[model samples]
Target: MRLDKFLKISRLIKRRTLVKEVAEQGRIEINGSVAKASSKVSAGDELTIRFGQKILTVKIQDLKEHVKKEDASSLYTVIKEENIQQPTRHE
Candidate 1:
């Protein structure tokens, strides 16, 4: 499946357009490299998404064209999630 579609179908990004924008802007990475919206993804691939100050890392477990809200979490496994610490400014 396409990276953008996978993100939306998995309920990670909430919208397909947002997923595309994020992929285009280089906020999403797959298997340690920056990936585009059209990148092909499959089972066992690692995905990292940088959203604001939080970074979410998940491993793709399964891919589906559509998934219900209650079953969304089954699509991937959260490997790690960390909040990026901002450096304090000194005036």
Candidate 2:
């Protein structure tokens, strides 16, 4: 499945366009390498996504074309999620 579609269907990003934009900006990666919106993904692939100040890493467990909101999370396993601390401004 394409990265954008997978993210959308999995309810990770909530939208396809945003996924594409994020991927283009190099905020998405697959297996430690930068990934594109059209990048091919399969089961067992690890995806690291940076969303603003939070970073989320998930491993693809299944690739489904369509899934209900309640079951969307079944597609991937959350490995970790962390918030990026911003540096404080100093005078």
Candidate 3:
């Protein structure tokens, strides 16, 4: 499945457009390589996503076109979450 679609279906990202934007900005990676919104995602693939001050790493556990809110968390397993400091501005 498409990376963007999977992210939404898995409830990782709340919106499809945001996924696209994140992927385009090179903040998403798959299997240690930078991936695009159209990148194909499958079971066992490692996904590292940057969300604001948090960096999340998850391994894809399953792929589904539709899932309930209660079951969405089952699609992927969180490997780690790290807090990152934002870059300071320089004039």
Q: Which candidate is the best by TM-score?
A: 2
**Local lDDT at 45 for model 2:** 99
- lDDT string for model 2 (1-91, tens) is 8999999999999988999889999999999999999999999999999999999999999999889999999999999999999999999
The candidate 1 region of ten consecutive residues with least summed lDDT is 16-25
Candidate 2: where is the Cα deviation over 4 Å? none
- Give the whole-model CA lDDT for all candidates, comma-separated: 0.94, 0.96, 0.96
Model 2, backbone clash pairs (residues 3+ apart or across chains), number: 0
Cα misplacement distance, residue 60 of candidate 3 (Å) = 0.2
The local distance difference test score of model 1 is 0.94
Q: Report the C-alpha lDDT of model 1 over 1-91, residue by residue, as the tens digit.
A: 9998899888999998898888888999999999998999999999999999999999999998878999999999999999999999999
Model 2 scores a TM of 0.97
